[model samples]
Target chain A: MVELLAQTGLNAVYAASYISLVAVGLVLIFGVMGVVNFAHGELFMAGAYAVVALYADMHVPFFVAVAIGMAFVGLLGLLMEWALFRPLKDNPLGGLVASIGFLMILQSLAVMGFGVRMEHIPPVTQEVVRFTDKVGLPVARLYVIVAAVVFLSALWYFLKRTRFGWALRASAQDPEAAALQGISITQTARIAMFIGAALAGVAGALTAPLVSVNPHMGHSVIVTAFIVIIVGGVGSLEGAILASIAYAFVHTFVTTFWDGVLADIVGLSLMLIVLIVKPTGLFGSADRA
Target chain B: MRNFLILLVGLAALIALPHGLSFSQQEILVFLVINVLLVTSYRLLTLTGEWSLGHVVIMGVGAYSSALYTKELGVYVPVSMLLGAVTAALLAVLLSFPLFRMKGFYFLIGSFAAGEIIRLIWKRFREPFGGVRGISGIDPMPDFSVGFYQFDFFEPVSYYYFAGAIVIACLWILWRIEKSPVGLTFHAVHWQDKLAQASGVNLRAYRTLAFAIASGFAGLAGALQGHYVGTVNPNSFDIEVMVFVLTWAIVGGTATFYGPILGCIVLTVLNEIVLREMGLEQARPLIYGAIMILSILFLPNGLESLVQKATRRKTTAKPEEKAAT
Candidate 1:
């Protein structure tokens, strides 16, 4: 029983890592741009397809493929900003609607390029860290945990310590005021888009080996990400990360103990309960609420 | 008189459409009506500046509820539909108390969460909603006799007419709301909530009322769809459907009541034609994405705006030409 709980805990952590990566990026984009990029999960999907195209198909180095995937998808994000959001800057709704369209385009492109079938990604690692006779942690999942910690810490350091980071946060907090402080809103937006896209890309690249990869896979991820961000509060990065962890744990546990369908129900119920009790989310400010 | 004639013509076309189309074509038309109903109801909610990304879930509530009640409890279809709509409205009202406190994007996300919660509940209760597979074999609307006419709703044409009538009725209600004082309050809230509040307007009440009304209409659409489709799956109410409905509204013009209707017709036809003719399954998303991008960039107000602009230009051009001459 203890071992089972330990295993489930490990699974929960793994789920938390990916969910946080996706959710934090979403929050960052929403914070800086004031436009919810509905195509974000598709960016993640594009990243997985990048791996499928490179490492799985061409026998490229796995790490190199992941890096390329992240950069490539980040570049796509930059292109989207340049092509869509930049022009629609005056209308947030316009940007959002455009992003939804871009999402469909990406999905179709994937289908055309890779067909509708799920692409199989070979496991990166077969080893496991044993805690007991019946309990163990898969090394692949451990990689996700380590990557999340390192990436999140790096993000925190950048946001808290770096010059560009302050500019980004300042712009997010108040664009006009940030500009008064000599911050370039355009540059900050570019940076936010890149980082946000890269985070989603990295999450997808890392998780590709574990989950079934297909064109429609982003649909679920995007929904889950939305739930996390909402439960976390819209513009709060800290809220997104924390809520992602909480949502992931609850969802994973429910799925393990009960059923996948029920797990979704419980996950949503948790969001409703949160909304009813704390409209501002766990870490969100009242002003934002 | 002109507007009345236009509406009468539209109603005539709607009533006669199913008879002109084949059975499969009639099915598509029914789907269009459902889409139109859902999208218009969505617009009704958006009037208060509360954009919900989870409307498909509200529709799902109605679909699942009606499907379950009729299939499981042996309830009459109309009664089940009413129950579903009321239940959805009640849920919307209950959720609105907390949700209305939040502004802009926060309200959007809150409503999204509410929709997901309802969807989850339906999915979790397998005995009630049939879980993931959803409720199937929903009984069609029964045949009934009025004084001089027999209506068999199971027939495609009959179903289309039934759905069309509901659409017309809902549209009438929406039109009335849009022209009423409540509609002004809704617009006031959307444009400037603070000002609306300062002027003694209960912003929360108006917003909540709009949401409840929209959800109720969504439920009605869902019930109709459930009976028509003969199945109600959890998957049908997922985010993709919400996005699709949203796309319809955006492409058509969210500012006008008829925008979604136009969008539904254009996109649905495009979807059918493109998917069938090109065999470019993958290209469909790309096409949709391109359309959305172009629409946002060039036609932010939607196709309706273009028509309005063109007509205004034509009207103004005649005076300029006469003066120049």
Candidate 2:
């Protein structure tokens, strides 16, 4: 029982790692843009396809492909900022509807390019680290866990210790005040969008080999991200990370013990409970959410 | 008198419409009528300044309830459908307890989570909902002869007439609700809730009322869908359908009553007829997405703006715009 519990803890850690990556990016974009990006999951899918093309197809190094995936998806975010979010900045609803439109465009593009079927990515590594006969972590999965920690820590340092990070947060807090303080609102929004998009992309790229890569795969990822962000608090970064960890444990454990559908139900129920009890979330200030 | 004449002419045209269309086109018309109900009901919910991502799921709630009521409890299909709608409205009331705590983006996401839970419930239970495949072999609306036409369930035109009449009735009721003092209060709740509250408007109650009413109509639409299609699956009412409803509401512009209905008709024609004829089925979503993005950028006010521009009758357009947001 102890070994099983440890194994589940490790699984939850891995789950929390990638989930926080996606949730944090979602929080960042919402913080800066004040628009709910319905197309974010597609951006993650775009990252996975980046891996499929560069790493799996072109035979580039795995880490390099992951980097390209991150940058490429970030560029896509820049495109969205220029085209959709910028013009609809004042109209949050318009921005949201436009993102839904963009989601369709991305999904259809994927269907057209790769077909609707799942693309099997070759295993990047077959090695596993074992603590017991029945308890083991695959090296590929470990890569996702490690990358999430490194990228998230770097993001933490960037936000807290860097000048632009402060500017980003300032803009997120109050756009007009930030603008008066000599921060460019447009530039901050672009940077936030790019970084946000890159994080989701990198998470998708790292986990591509472990899951089925397909056009519709983003649907579940986006759902999970929404659950995490809502439970975490919409604009609070730390809340998102903590909520991601909490949700990962509950969801992974429930799925392990019961069923997948029930696990989804439980996760969504938890989000609803949070919204009812504390609409702002566990770590969120009431004003932000 | 002039308005009455226009109504008569419109009714005649609608009654005559299916005769000119092919069988498939007639079927599309039936679905379109049902969708007209869905989108218009969605507008009613938006009237309170909240857009719900789970409206489609609420529609599914009605579908499953009505389907099961008829299938399991041996209720009349029509009565069960009404009960289904009532069930949906009640469910909305229940959900509003938890959901109305959050406003704006939080409300949107909260509604989504509530909807997802409901959908997962349908997916998890196999006894009645039939799991992922959903409830199939649903009971159809029994055929009856109208004096002007012998209604046939097998033929799509007959169902079109039946659904058309029901939809017209629902729209009439919705129009009355919008025009009434209650509608003004809904608008008040939307535009300046705090001030309205100062003036004794129960903001929460009004919001919940609008949500319940909207869910009821959406449920009715779902029942219409189930009876016509003879199947009710979880996949049938997914986010894609909700996105379509949102697209119609946004692209057609929500400022006017006719906006979303107009959007529903035009987009349906474009998606079903124009794209289908061009033989670009696979590229349909791509083209549709492009249209959505382009229109949002250029026609932020929606197709209703164009209608207003062409008619040159500026009546209430400006005031309505303020109330719209």
Candidate 3:
């Protein structure tokens, strides 16, 4: 019984890794740009598709394909900003509406480029660290765990210690103030968009092998991301990461114990309960709320 | 008298539209009416500066509630529809307590989460909502004999008219609400909630009331849709549908009362005409996305603003020309 709980804990941690990557990016973009990029999940999808196109099809090295996928999707984010967001800067609703439109375009493009069928990618590693007969961790998943830790730690350091990172944080905390302090809102927005998109891309690329890759797969990810953001408070990055871990544990455990359908229900119910008790979320300050 | 005449003419045109078009076109019109009703309900909450993205889920609640009641309890269609709307409204009221405390983007996310919770409930409760496969063979509205004529809602034209009437009724109520003192207060709250509250407006009550009214209308639209479509699926109320409704409202212009109506009509027409011609299944969304982006960049107020601008330009030009002449 103890072993089973330990195994579930391990699984929860794995889920938390990728989920935080996606949620943190989502929160960062929202914090800086003040626009919810509804097409965010599609960017994640684009990353996975990059892997399918490069490594699965062309036989590129797995890590190289993942790198290429992250960069490519990050560029897509830059394009979105230039084409849609920058033009609609004054109107948050306009930016949001445009993102929704972009989401549809991406989904359709994916469908056109890759048929509706789920693309199968060969496993990057078959090696698993067995703790017991029924408990083991796949090396591929371990890569995700390690990548999340390193990237997130690096992100923390950059935000706390680096110059550009302070600029990013300052812009997010108060754009007008940051602008007055000589921080370029435009530059900060671009940086935020790129890093945010890249985070989502890396998460998608890393998890592509674990999940079914399809045109519409972004639908669920975006939904889950939204739930996490809401539970974390809309603008708090720390809240997003923490809430992602909490949500992932609850959802994954429920799925393992009961069913996927019920797990979704319980997950949403948890969101509602949190909202009812604390509308600003656990980490969201009243001012931010 | 002029306004009454316009209304009569509008009603007459709507009544005659189905007869002038093919069955498929009538089906499209029915769907358009559904979109119109849903969009109007969405606008109701937005009037108070509270945008509810999960409104499609309220519609889903209505759809599923009525669907299940009729399918399982064997309830009469009218009763089932009423129950559905009530349930959805109740849920909205229940959720508003928690949701209303959050402002702006937080509120939006809260409502969105609530909607997802509702969808999750439907998906989980297989016995009630039919799970993933969804509830099929929903009994259509039965025939009714009124003195000398029998009316059946099963026909596409009849369903269109029925749906259109509900839509018109909803629009009328919304129009009345928009013109009411409460509506003025809602606008005031939307523009500046702090000021409105300072001036003795109970912001919480008004916001909650707005959400309830909107959710109620969404439920009505959903119920009508279930009867019209004769099927209820959990997928119908997903985020994608919410995006479409939001797009319609945004494209039409959120500033005017008639924006959603115009948006629904234009998008529905474009979707029918252009989506059919493209042969590329994904082209419609791509084009839709392009249009939304361009519209947002160029016409922040929406397509209605364009018309308003054009009319104003003409009126201004006429005065200048008269002076010159």
Task: Tell me the number of clashing residue pairs for each predicted model.
Answer: 4, 0, 0
Off by over 4 Å in 3: A286-289, B1-5, B145-150, B314-325
Supply candidate 2's per-residue lDDT for B47: 90
Say which prediction, candidate 1 or candidate 3, comes out ahead on TM-score.
3
Candidate 1 has an interface RMSD (Å) of 2.3
DockQ of 1: 0.64
Over 4 Å off in model 2, which ranges? B313-325
Clashes of 1: 4
lDDT digits (tens) for residues A77-125 of candidate 3: 8998888888888776778888888888898899888988999999999
Candidate 3 chain B: worst-modelled 10 consecutive residues by lDDT: B316-325
Instruction: Compute each candidate's TM-score over C-alphas.
Output: 0.92, 0.97, 0.94
Q: Once model 1 is optimally superposed onto the true structure by TM-score, how far is the C-alpha of residue A217 displaced, in angstroms?
A: 2.2
lDDT of 3 by residue, B81-200 (tens): 989999899989988877886777767777887787777777767787777778888988887766664567767887776677677888899889989998998888888888989999
Better of 1 and 2 by TM-score: 2
Please give me the total number of clashing residue pairs in predicted model 2: 0
Query: Which is the better candidate, 2 or 3, if ranked by TM-score?
Result: 2
Model 2 chain B: worst 10 consecutive residues (lDDT sum): B316-325
